[model samples]
Target: MDPRSPPPGDGRLTPADLRLWAVLGLALVFLALAALFLAAPALGALIYGVPAPEGIGRTALRAIGARDAALALYLAGLALFSTRRAVAIVLAASLVIPACDLVLILSAGTAAWWQVALHGVSAGVLALTALWLARRNHSA
Candidate 1:
């Protein structure tokens, strides 16, 4: 076979492909959550146990929504247009968001245990997925 030719199994979907699909799904979920926050800032704030002071809460939630939306778009773009290495790098670096979220929620002293757990779990998953993707890409 020529060196320029595709790999033997190039047409087949592998486990890495499935994981990439899952990452895309996660990105969509983030986008949906962003929309939810944008549409219902009060509810979002309530869920996060953030103080939605009468005038400032809604504004803060909207800003958070925009930030989440931008993040989702970035993840989506990386997954769709970039190489696996780039996606892995972004996913790994993005762990900061969830880590900060967990810390902020804990510091606020209003979030439920479940909220903290959610952030922690999210960070773990993102970390693991990033490592897996990076290793797989390196091996490939």
Candidate 2:
């Protein structure tokens, strides 16, 4: 069997497969970031003395983590099937979620500068990674 050929049976991943994996990996990271943002209050309450908003924070956290988990599962699917387009679409959606979170956090005006910076950096890293993966998709 040629190593260059797709995996035997149904589970085979090639260079292109890896590229898709990279995309999905980046998405997972971003989804994690978004989850962190949404879970900020719960996190803070768990850690610091800062008071969280009412039901809003809880709802947001649930949504964020739920989506993040879903994205992670999709990423796992990419790994299993070795398909690029499907993973790319999921990753692209992952990117948008964090960008929206960044905008919301900035507009909310309650968060500290450092928190904004951290989230911004995380979002940038995720986007950059996905872009690189897309560019190197064929080589993966």
Candidate 3:
């Protein structure tokens, strides 16, 4: 094989490939934040009363802020060569937190339909982005 050609299964991603992944990840983070902002208060109203469910509301707010912060960090990482894998790892980690939250909400028997919908949509987007990134990395 030519030395210039990447070997099969080398697990390396080109800069362009990495950029695509980063963009998709950043989009997911923003989408999640937006959805949380719109949905969380409504969800709180449905589950609790006019006041709001303090515990769940607080958690949702935190998730929104965390997602935004994660996106900022992800973009910064994307620009730094040493942080490429770190960005991917952080994006990957973001997926798990929401999933666990979904499970917890479901177990509470609180009829968290909006949360499920938002989480499903966000997860689908993130998963697709991650898959594209992985495939591009593999091909590189």
Candidate 4:
């Protein structure tokens, strides 16, 4: 079979495409962010809308960074080596991250509107992308 002719579906908009670029794109994004958060927890917290952390608070940010890095590896690994369905399943499951972040940030009442909106939009996009991949995987 021609490598150019990817099997039908797999969530690619075109036959020549690999596991949707969105999956890989998101993975790369997370990886970059993970590095930033790991290297500079305070800055990462600020970017995430948290005020500059003090003392032990930085530990939590580091934990978040670690988690993000781990998730990024899993996502990228799946996109590269596993099936598209696996990527969709993982992406769908990962929705809890942004959803919980939105809720937590909102409940804290310390976040600006854009921060809250960012999380909300992230959750929305992840949900939509997961659904699109699933539906397209089934029908295309």
Q: Each prediction's TM-score against the native? A: 0.81, 0.60, 0.53, 0.82
| Residue-level lDDT tens digits of model 3 in 1-140 | 88765445533444565555665556565656556545675543343212344766666655555556566566455535433344456556667855865676577666456656766766676565555554534343
Pick by TM-score: which candidate is best?
4
Order by lDDT, highest first: 4, 1, 2, 3
lDDT (10s digit) by residue, model 2, range 46-75: 321223556765675556566666766767
- List per-candidate RMSD values in Å: 4.7, 6.5, 6.4, 4.8
Error of 2 at 133 (Å): 2.4
Candidate 1 per-residue lDDT over residues 65-123, each given as its tens digit: 88789878887787776666677778898899888887787889989877778788889
- Local distance difference test values of all predictions, in order: 0.74, 0.57, 0.55, 0.77
Off by over 4 Å in 4: 1-15, 137-140
lDDT of 3 at 20: 50
Clash count, one per candidate: 0, 1, 0, 0
After superposition on all CA atoms, how large is the RMSD of candidate 2?
6.5
- Which consecutive 10 residues in model 4 have the weakest lDDT in total? 11-20
Q: Score residue 20 of candidate 1 by CA lDDT.
A: 62
lDDT of 4 by residue, 19-65 (tens): 45777778878888889888999888777877868888888888888
